[model samples]
Target: MILEHRTYTFKPGTVDKWMKKYEAEGLPIQKRHLNRFVGLYVSEIGVLHTTVLMWAYDSLADREARRQAMYADPDWQSFIAEIWALDAILQQDVMIMNPAPYSPPV
Candidate 1:
């Protein structure tokens, strides 16, 4: 199993606005194509105006296929357009992780 961790850094003071747009337009599309939804988070201390998403997959190929499908979906494309209109995102970081031996299984 593998996990995909994504951290999105948004322009300062626009987190709430962007998050609202994502929740309304993006979450449903993600739910349809993404494999496992772990959690969504916002930074409060160290990195302000940042959002994080975590997802689990059977393998890297599975992750790639799912994401590709999502990107091709019309709904997802529109959501991307909406986000681009907001122009709030500054940077995005993605990390592919494997569970440590000592880590408990979900």
Candidate 2:
């Protein structure tokens, strides 16, 4: 499994708006249908007021395939466009990790 980190530089005061809209509209589609999100976080103290998204899958190929499918799908594309409208600039960085060793609440 790996995590996909998406950093969004939201316009001022857009966090609450984006968050509410995202949870209200976007999240249900992702969570119920795609199982596309594992975690989301915002920087409390950092250089970038970024939002990080973590996603888990069985393997890298599985991750790629799933995300690609989402990217291609019309519904996902529209939802992403809505999210993008909230950001000043957005960047994505993907990290592949080995988390099994330190997982499951030690």
Candidate 3:
């Protein structure tokens, strides 16, 4: 299994707004398209304005396909457009990971 880890850093004080918007709109759209939704979290101690999202997929190809479909959705497109207009995001980091043999199933 492969895990997709996405971390987004928003401008100061804007993370809450972004999270609310995502929960109300983006989450639903992603839930429909993604196969294994892991979780979403915010950093409390280290990175104040950052949010982390985790997703599991059977393979890289599966991740790509699912993400492609989600991107093609009009609702998702519109939601992202609004996010971009907000200009809240400062940076984004994405990583594809593999669990260690001893790691528990995600």
Shift in Å, residue 10, candidate 1: 1.1
lDDT of 3 by residue, 8-65 (tens): 9999989999999999999999999997889999999987899999999999999999
lDDT of 2 at 95: 63
Q: Count the backbone clashes (under 3 Å) in each candidate.
A: 0, 0, 0
Order the candidates by lDDT, highest first: 3, 1, 2
TM-score of each: 0.94, 0.71, 0.96
lDDT of 1 by residue, 1-106 (tens): 8988999999888899988887898988998998989889998899888889999998999989999999999999988998898889899999999999887654
The pairs that clash in candidate 2 are none
Instruction: Check candidate 1 and list the clashing pairs.
Output: none
TM-score pick, better of 1 and 2 = 1
Superior candidate under TM-score, 1 versus 3: 3
What is the Å distance of residue 54 in model 1 from its true position?
0.7
Global lDDT for candidate 1? 0.90
Number of the candidate with higher lDDT, 1 or 3: 3
Model 2 TM-score, all chains together: 0.71
